[model samples]
Structure formats: C-alpha cells, structure tokens
Target: MAITGTSSFSVNSSPVFRRDVTSASGNLKRNLDLKRFAVSSEQATTSSTTTKKFVENGRMWKKSGEESETARRVNVEESERNGKSLKDYFDEAKDLIRSDAAPPRWFSPLESGSHTRDSPLLLFLPGIDGVGLGLTTQHQRLGQIFEIWCLHIPVEDRTSFADLVKLVERTVRLENHRLPNRPIYLVGESLGACIALAVAAHVPDVDLVLILANPATSFSKSQLQPLIPILKLLPDQIPFSLPYILRLLEGDPLRMAADNLVKGLAPEPTFGKLSHDLLTMSSYLSVVADILPKETFLWKLELFRLASAYANSRLHAVKAETLILSSGRDQLLPSQEEGEKLRLALPKCQTRRFDDSGHFLFLEDGVDLVTVIKGAGFYRRGKYIDYVSDYMPPTPSEFKKIHESNRLIYLATGPVLLSTLEDGKIVRGLAGIPSEGPVLFVSYHMLLGLELYPLVTQFMIESNILLRGIAHPMAFKRLKDGKLPELSTFDTFRMMGAVPVSAANFYKLLSSKSHVLLYPGGMREVLHRKGEEYKLFWPEQSEFVRMAARFGAKIIPFGAVGEDDIAELVFDYNDQMKIPYFKSIIEEATNGVINVRTDASGEVANQQMHWPYFVPKVPGRFYYHFGKPIETEGRKHELRDREKSHELYLQVKSEVEKSLAYLKKKRERDPYRKMLPRLVYQATNGFTSEVPTFEP
Candidate 1:
C-alpha cells in the first residue's frame, strides 16, 4: 500500500472475504467470497489474463480468461488494488485470520493480473502472518510479468515446519517438471523466506530465483530472544498474549506504521494532516489487535525458530540465485546487518537494503518489489537472464525518480548539450539528432563516466528517447569472491536500460532496432591517466562499425568533455599499479570482474576495474556535442569489406575527437559555463530557470 497518493481512500467494514480453506491445486469448490484488496490511493491500474491450459493427472482443465470470467475478475481486482495501501493488507489479513481455515494450500488469485506467455511461475510464500497475501501492495505490478501463485498457510492450521517445506518443495518440483525451461521465482518474506530457502536447499540443482524480503534466518540473534521462553511456557488458551506478541513483533504497530507512512509522500505533507491520519490509523490497528491469538501466535513463533534453524544449517546446499531485501528499521530482526552476512554466506547472492523500511518491508508504503527486481536485472524468461531481452524500460515515474536521484550530479556538473542534424546545423538540445530507432550514439566516455547521468536523463527528458547503454559486466555479474562490494550504482543503470557489454548484446540491440549507447573507448577512457583527459583510447580494429552497418544503424559520433573542470585526477589506475598496496587491491577487485579485450594490446585493452582518486575543483559545466549521423542503411555490403569498415571506424573516431575539440573551444565563450556564474544567473531569474549556454 502506497502512503503517497493524490486522493484519499478508505477501507470500509464488512467487506467480502474468500472461503476459509482450499485444497492443493485449489479449485473454488466452496463458492468463496474471495475478497479483493481494494486500493487506498489514486494510482493508475492495469490488468492481465492468464491463458495457459492445465493438465491435472492427464485430465486437461483448460481454464483461460480469454473465454471465461477470469478476465473480468482480473479487471475488477486490478482496478480495486490500483493503489493498495497498508490498510488494505491489514483488512485482507484480518479477514484471513478471522476465517477458520485448515492446512496449507496453493491458490492462483484469478485476479492476480495478466502475464506474458513466457512469464515464469512466481510462487509467493507468506511471512509469519501466513496469509500469503503480503504482496498485496505489489500484486498488480508483479502480475504484469509473472504467472502468480500464492501459498496460504492458515493461521489456525498447525502444519509443522518440515511439512511446510515438503509442501512447497512438491509444488516447486511439479511446476519445474511441467515447465522445465522457465525459472520459477520464489518470492518470500520473513518466515516464508525461510521456507523458500529450505526448498532451495532441498532441490539444489533446480533452476530457481529467490527474492527474500526481511528473511527470518537471523531470528536466533534478534530481540525476539525473550519471546521464545514465553511462547514455550504459554498455554493454548492464553488469549491475553496478543499485546505481548505485538510488542515482540515491534514496539508499536501503530507507531511504526505512522512513522513510515509519510515517507516518500507525494505533493509534500503537513505535520497536522499526518498527525490526524496517524491517530486514525492507531485506532484502526487497535480494532484488529488480536488478529493472531494465543495458539496461532505461539505456532508462528515456534515455526520461525525451527525454520530459521533449518535454513541456516543448509545454507551451503542452497544454490539458487538469491536476492535478499533487508530493511534497516526492522525491529523484529537485524535485517540490515544480516544482509551483509547473507551476501557472504550464499554462493550466488546479492542484497539491496531499504534503510528506512521495517520488518514488513513489502507491506511498507514506499517499497516496490517489481522495480527492485528490474533494477537488479533479476527478471528473466528462461534459465539464463539475457540483459537485453529482460530489460524493462523505465516508466515516467521511474525516469523522474532516477533524474531526481542524480539531480545533485546534474547540479554539480552543469551539462550543456548540442546535437548536429544531417544538414550539419547544431541545436541546443537533441533536436538535431534523428528521432528514430537503431541509432547508435558512440561517445567518448568521460572520466569515471560522470557524464552518463546527465546524458541519459537529458535524452529522456529533452527528446523523449531512451538510451540503452552498453555497460561493463560488473554491473550485471555478481562476484562471489567478495573482493569488492557490489556496485549498487549499477542498479540505476539497469533500471535505465543499460545492458552488459557483449558482442551478442550489441547485435541484439541493433537487430531489435533499439537506440544504443556505446563507449568504444570503454574503461580505457573512463579511467584514464592524469594527462589523458578527453583522449580517445578506441580499439585498433573496427569492432562496432561492421556490426552497425550490417544492421543499418545510424552511427552518431558524439563527444563529452569537462571532466577536468570538475575534478583533477590525483591518483589513477597507472598510479595505483605503481604502488604495491593499491596494486594488490586492484588485482583482488578485478579478479572476478569479466575479462574484456583479453587478446588485445594497448590502452584500449586495459579493462582493469579501479576507482581513480581525485580532488574536486570549482564545479564546472559539462559540454556534449553530437556530430551528424553517419548513415549505414545502404552501406552494409560496402562495410562488409574490411577496408571500408576500418575507414568508416576511423572517420567516426575523428568526428568524436572533432566534437571534443569543438566543445572545449566553444565553452570558453560561455559566460555561465562555471558553477558560480550559472548559479548567479539562475538566482537572478529563478533557480528552476535554465541558465544560458553557448549559442548553438
């Protein structure tokens, strides 16, 4: 549920509720109410319909929304959950707890939204609450790409932890057998995360992706230590334990919810309004205080203890690709600290932290699971993730978010953009570049690739174009050695459609007629020496021209200069190599990083990953110029000839150098190229006003 919305939404009492229990491969035998979690925000809604036919014990039950009421349910539910809020989850969970259900079952929410034909099966295992409805906030977005199934372990059901694992394992095995090629996603939270891990441990060889939020594996060391003794001593009929249980869960559910609600709110917030909402929410949670009464509460706590022990013991056996989402303010567990520990423990694992979030990370207002998966480049259709195919283009909201995140970078290095049309007329923005597909922008990578944010964001904001950057493998690959911490910055790059650099990916981008951003100079230019600023360290051979010509891509040779203006390289890769300590660190860091240009010599082949220490200067402006697009439509056959390809490549390189020189020279004439003048100009006018740049 998002706390941030334009209009208000309220959860009414006496809402519809689904039947108490379900059978395995659950059918709607009870004419259940199957309550839909309604939205408490004004977010836009979208729907999807699952069309795959089912084969149950050789009997074909072809249930599809295309010809049935399934589609209607999807529409109705999606619209209802358009902007799910914390209250919706509480309401649905309250309904589940109130119903006297038995046994654990897997059920597909007919309204789980639609998915692609090749969408992998995503089985959600619920947290301690055991309703499996924890993903209510993320249901609509997750539905867009995953065939969803949710595991419901009834609050009243006293299923042992081992049996729970068996049930999930059985479901995983059966699904894998049916769709062997597709990777099943195990989206788990807390206790559910433990179940997912145990299943992964049991089926080590199976293809699976685990997305665990606030995993309870660290429960043994949490503040819940005192609860274990109390839980064991409590009698079955101790109805007075709800407040104690809630206390162990967190300090105060109302306070926690209220504190996190105003975070990331839209259109700003007033303290007075939030205070009123906080009071109202406090009353709401109190109304349903005993959702998990004595017996069920004790059962969940015991399950957590057993599941944690079970999963932690077999950590070595679990081989599935795992993403751990750790919340910083998680009072129930030390999730933030545990994330770092888990990253080292798992063979194939990565962790993303939400410092402001709590134990119920998924249920929190600001968290978006789908976006996190996409940013982490975890979405895939088959056994392997093809960065190019799995890349999800950023939505308007995402683009704006990315821009705002890097806004300081923009202000720190004020960017001035210029592009040339086919007629050689220079324009202030992207107006001169062709607004079409298959356009390859080959730019000189500025120092540390500092120009990237400005370039990518401006292209999206100014020209309404998305630049699919060909990036380094470190952005996509996880280094198991833990020699260097994973680059969290790359998450934004992946979110903005940056694919790992590879010959195949380049071909895929061009073949798909997508706009591609390439840095032919690669890391050689990005992490250059003290004196190599604005210098092109491109490969000796024409690696990209032939491929670009084959696909008839428009190669736009561009240049961005001004790294020297913002900072001076006090220590570089060359300097690091000279010192023994730094050299060892570099070797260890790049040990697991992908080897690029292994057979090549010269500066262009130097693909070592190292951060050059630099000293900041007075903030200066960055200048970018895109030269005229070199047409390759009719020159494919011509470029197939080696001489022609090399000739064209050299021509592109020369143009890039020319643009660099042009920007270097022209910026000298601009009065507001430096920070102080630009600030003064904007201050005199409006801070939101665009400071003037050199005349195009």
Candidate 2:
C-alpha cells in the first residue's frame, strides 16, 4: 500500500525513524499523544482535485503546516530525553571541535525590521535525498531579513543534462514574465553544487554561487559502481510490485518528509529544533538512495560513469562575482583543502571556510546560514539578460559596428613631422598637444594615410582612453555618414556607445567627456619637398589659438614623429570642384589605394616596435608621453592674451620633443630593428608583429 506523510511511529519498533517536534514546556499539560493515519477515504478522493488548485492558490503554508506536524515528532522526543536546552547541545558541540576541523560560521541573521525585498534572488539546491523542507523554515527567519527563492531538482530524467538546461531556461523565462526584474543567486549542496556550477557556466547572469559539502574531487566510478544498474531502469519492477522489491527499495520516509517541510518553509524557516531536525534528515537520504537505480552491474556502471562526469566537470571560465562555502568538518566530502585547491584554480573566486558545520550546514547554522547566502546579492528574474554570445566587445562583427558608430576622428592641428632613413622605407607619426581644461580634443586627420593606424593605436591602448576627434570634410565624405545596413545592435562594434558630433556642435561636444581629435595641419602636412622628409608643414589658417582661447583649455602639445616619413600624403584640395584624375586617385588611395610611390625614409621611422607588434625596435618606436596637466580654466574671457596661451603651448611642444628624443634613444638596439619587412606590411603599422627571432 502506498503511504504519504507517515506521521508517528513507535520508538520500540524503529530506532532510525525520528520526528522533529515542537512543545509548550512549563505549560499546564505536557502529555500529548502522537498518532499516524492516512488521509481518510473521502480526503484521498479529494486530494487529486485539490493538489493543482492548492499549489496555484499560494497554499505553500498549508503544505508546510501539514509536513511540519509530521516532522516535529522526533524533535519533541529529543528535547524530553536531553532535558537541557537545544541551544546548550549545539553550544557544547561547537566548543569541543578541534581547531583543524573548524569551518567558517554562517553570518548572523540581520534583524527582521532591517530586511528588504530589494535583495537579489538566491536559489538553493539540496544534496542526495535532500528535500528542502527543514532548510525552508530556517530560511524564513532569514527571508524576513532577506528575499530568497528555493527550487526543487528533479531526480528523474525529465530530460538529459542538455535538455534539462533548456528546461531551466524556459522556467526562467516564464518566471521573468511573472515577476519584476532582479538578479539571482544560486546555492547548491553536494550533487546540486555540480548542477549549479553547470548552470552558472551557461547562464552569465548568475550573480553568486554557493557550494556545500561537494564530493567532486573524490567521487569516482568505484563510489557509485554498486548503484548504477538500478538507475538505468529506475523504479525497478514497477508494474510487478512485490513485497521483497518494496523492502529493498524503501528509503527514509521521515527525512523525505523533512525535505518537504523545508521546501514548504521557503522564504522563511523555523529553527528552534535545528539539531533534532538534522539528525532526522539522514533517514530521508537513505530512502532516496534505495529507490535510485541498482539493477544490472553494467547499467549501474554506466550510471556511475555519468554521475562521476557530471560531478567532476567544471566551467571553463567564469566572469561573474562568485563565492564558495565549504565545510572542513564535512563527513561526505574530503577536507576543505580540496575546496582550496578548486579556489586556486579559479583565482578570481572568493571563498569562505566553515570548520564546525558538516555537509548540512543550512541546518547547523539555521538563520545564520540564510543571512550569509542572502548577503551575496542574489536575484530572482528579469534583472539581467541571459548569457548572450555578443556581450563581449571583442566579437569581430560587433567590434566593427561599434567602430563605425563611434567615428573616432584623429585630428591633426599642428605641424606634422615625416622622415625616412633608406629606400623602400616609409616613416611617419603625429604629436598631439591638448589644451588644459575639460574641453573637447580636436587634432589632425588621416585616412588610408598609414599614420592613422599608429595614431589610433597610441590613443586607445597606450593612453587607455576612448578618444573622439573631428573629421575633415573630405574624411566625412568618404565615410558616407556611418549608415551601413545589416548591422546588429547586439554587436559591440556597432559603436552604439559612441557619439558622432559635428563641427556645428563642436563647443558643446568639447564641453562633454570625450577626448576630441583634430588635425590643423590638414593637407599641408602630407605635401613634402623631394629631400625634406622630416618637416612640419602647418596650414596658414589654423583653429588652435581660437579654440583654446574660446574654451579656456590648456594646449597639450604632442608631436607625430614618423608620420611625414611613411608615404607622401597625396591629395588635391580642389578635387571637389570637378577635378577628374586627381579626384579618382584620391578616391582610390583613400580607400586603401596601393602601388603609389612609398617614402623610403618614411618606412624607417616605423621601426620602433611596441605591444601588438611584440617586436623590438625596427626603424623607430612611437612614444606618446603625457606632460604635466595644464591648468587653463577661467581663461575663456582672456581672448586678447593670445601670446600668453601660445607661450604655454610652446612649453607643451618642447616637452613632446624631449619625450620623442628619449624614445628614439631607448629603441636604438632593440631586436625588432633586424626584421625590416615583417615589421610593416605583414603587421599593419607594426601593431601585431611577431617577436624577432634571435640566434643563440
């Protein structure tokens, strides 16, 4: 006969079956009789009809009350036998533990009045035969001070591990739709810990993960070999149920009842009889073990293999904040040192040790356990998106999109220097000077101008800042206004995070948090005389003094050393006025036009290889040394003091010259200087050149 909610049993017949009890000690009457009975005939008939409605109607309270009535019996007996207070037993045990065995203690529960639902959602997982009942009561005391959610793990293969994950995804989606958005936390015990880690790997949104008494390191086929066969065809002899089959298959009914009780108390738990409740938990585990598969030896072996793999597996990499809680005094798992080893492997994770508690710390620590888990910042649903492959900005298409959207304009507003040391060598670079004040940065411009790459690389990687600059009219014409179709917003490259400001809003843009780039040298820097390779050519009409004075910003002068040495900057200012041949050449070269005459001397200027290149000095290494920050605030009205601003600008210019000379000397004997050809074309501005090979 099938039995549900087994209530009370005679202590004379069963030493193992124990109940968790509640009592009104020092009251008028102490004698209260306990009895076990199945649901009445009429009640049984109504159960099926009521089950769905009851669950849907928030009848968790009813379910827990019923379960608790059954679970409390053993505890009542323990209190009577011990006579002393339950707290005294725990306190005594706590004091006697060896120093080496002490595990970390759970955090004390915050006062109920101090709790808020704004806390993140935390999911709890129980070990083998772990029903969440008892823990739920403890959690309730905790939930009063923190919001928490507990879920039941299916023992039966509702689906394979892969399919199971999909199921969880669906559940999460459903829950998100049902509730407000929030982050979620996950805490798993033993086997559940493995599942939790697996879920974290797949679900990037998980905030923190708590593991309890996991046996991953020591669990192998040998440990599970005896039980594998029955697992393959679970509930063996189901249709042909017999007495013998039942006897061998029965598990701890009381413990199972206790698990149900814990789950019922979700969001809050009663922890007065915590120790007695824990002792009774072992019975439920025993029952769960019996019903698990154990038929044929081969099938059992397969089950064991699968279990071992699942337990041992780990996420390849995790980026979310995480916490690992392990018990040094655990009976099932090895020493907490095993957890330490796992922590070492996951260098990014935070960990806490509990020496006093065993595998079931949730019971031992009770309300404190809830406090610790809740503090890690758990979320339930709707707070964050599921792990999307496009979240990282490194994805190629995403990166492309962001670049297109951000429109980083390299502005050159000064005399540009270009040079070369030999034939077939091109050398070119830029020096940027910024005006002090939190004003927008506007420098020079280059496209397919070779020097553009080095300038951008220096600003991004070396300076570690997202730079924005104003594009020349010609540069904008080629860009076509960043209107590329077939781009995804999910892609990081779409530059959704960047803003494309115009010259009309230049002042407003300068007032923002962007580092503006401008090239005042314009086309004048590209046109060089035959033998004058390294020369600064400035435009007659430049906006430097006007912009610095208007914004009251300091002028930070930076020099581009090798830019003039690369290739002759080929362009015609009147191309827009219907100049056919020159316009076509400009168009071709601007769009990566090649085969044009290369500046032999300009090539030598690129030899100073740095990161991305991994190569040492080739021709010359570009250096961007930031001088002291200039203070130019409140000078906006001092427009007539042009020479005063110019003097400060020259000081910046002098500093740039000093830094350039220092970089050149430092790279003179670097190994990359030996690999001439590989340093340029193959490495693209020598950004990612391979390190030069050396002869031993």
State every prediction's TM-score relative to the real structure: 0.87, 0.31
lDDT for each of the candidates?
Answer: 0.75, 0.36
Q: Which stretches of candidate 1 lie over 4 Å from their true place?
A: 1-81, 231-281, 285-290, 482-485
Instruction: Report the lDDT of model 2 for residue 582.
Output: 48
lDDT of 1 by residue, 562-619 (tens): 8989999998888889999999888888887887778889888778878889999998
Model 2 lDDT per residue over 1-696, tens place: 233333222111221112211111211111234321222344345433331101111011112122221110111111122222223323322222212121111111111111233444455544443232224334434343234433333233222344433434344444344343555555666555555655656665544444444434444523344444544555554522122222211122234346647678532233434435444333334333332323322332343345447545655554444556666555445536656655655534545566555555554532244324322222122344211111111112322333344432221211123222224132332223232223333332222233444454344433333343443233212222122221122122112112222344345434442354444433433333233333333332234555555655554444444433233433323422256754454444444312121232342122111111012122323323333334456666564466665665555445545545543454454444233443444367554433432121
Q: List runs of model 2 lying over 4 Å from the truth.
A: 1-117, 145-147, 153-159, 173-181, 205-218, 221-314, 365-367, 374-696
List clashing residue pairs in candidate 1: 1-84, 1-85, 18-34, 48-114, 49-114
lDDT (Cα, 0-100) at 449 in candidate 1: 91
